[model samples]
Target: PGLEVSMTMLAVDALLDEVAENRAHIGLAYNPPPHARIAYRASSAQPVVLLLRKDHPLAKRGGPASLNDLQAYPLALMPSTFGIGHVVSMAQVAANVSIRPTLVTNSLSALKRFVTAENFMTLVGEFAAYRELGSEELTTVAVAHPLFESAQARVLVKADRPLAAGPLELLKWIEERMPMFAPVKRPARRKPIR
Candidate 1:
């Protein structure tokens, strides 16, 4: 398992529930709490929150806009039950509008594609959008809402048993090597668990 890894996509709720049930080789869940264990975060650089093409009106606005300002632009958001569902939920509350997305998708690529094809925007973790934003394929935008937060993906072993040697090795490798891979500027610092 040098380069390949096992991954699964489940709503944050289910992910938590499954992990809580303690029944699988559950390694690395994002947006965790009841949903995850063995959290591993490797970024230590500035993270950009993204929007679509610069031509999109929200991206082109004259001055800094609050969450309310983002209300007018249709979004491509993950379903509210997904990890960090609060991002959308908070944006709506702050903007004080019954805002709904143009599309909701788990596929980050699809969200990026929708933005390119339709000028719609959404907020996603900087790491998720790193390459495109770096290559100029997707433009980064600022969300005036300090409501923004980053999440740590986690790695969990199956219930009762500890991690297998190989999986444990990979986990250690990630823990030791990932910080170097972070995007240049981190949005927040990664503090060790007290």
Candidate 2:
């Protein structure tokens, strides 16, 4: 199999443009806008959730967290330029809840690190912290809001352009594995046995 692939990370707007303009063969994005030249091949619901250390006080609640609950914590958030941040901004306004984050950055790693090293929380798409969740270093609390219910992870391609063998193959491969990336209802925390 002679397949070559190149991956580039872009903000949601630019990522959609790359696929629509045919600069990139395929794009994976969170809640991309509708474009005449882009088609969604597949999508998975990836709701916005609260990411914090497993032992954090909120995690002890063992249930969905309300946006207002965030007011009590030191919050770290991505700027509104990112998809998750934009959704969060809209949800905050719609719910009439105000959250003042202590730190704002575009870096996911920084957000993860801040929550891990300090008593801070960040809101992000559930899939964004897939690894940390798997390792049980962090856990997610579903945000109790309607706006967050529709966030999606999508596979996109040019509307009319047919993919060549390599890109098509890669697209098929990604489609088959999409469900693995979808959000799972995290189980309640279990106490450690000594």
Candidate closest to the true structure, highest lDDT: 2
Which window of ten consecutive residues has the lowest lDDT sum in model 2?
176-185
In model 2, state the lDDT of residue 71. Answer: 86
TM-score of each: 0.70, 0.84
* Local accuracy of candidate 1 as per-residue lDDT tens digits, 1-194: 45556667777666656555664344444444442343333433332255678787766764555566556777788778765465557556776767567788878788888888876887666667767777766677765555554444445444455666776677677656665433456489788999
Candidate 1 clashing pairs, residues 3+ apart or interchain? 16-35, 27-156, 28-154, 28-155, 45-185, 45-186, 46-185, 46-186, 47-187
Per-residue error (Å), model 1, residue 33: 4.5
Global lDDT of each candidate: 0.61, 0.86
Model 1 misplaced regions, further than 4 Å: 1-5, 33-48, 62-64, 91-97, 149-161, 179-194
Query: In candidate 2, which residue ranges exceed 4 Å CA deviation?
Result: 181-194
> How many clashing pairs per prediction, in order?
9, 0
Tell me the tens digit of each residue's lDDT in model 2 across 67-133: 7787889999877767777787788788887878999987889999999998899988887888999
At residue 54, candidate 2 shows an lDDT of 90
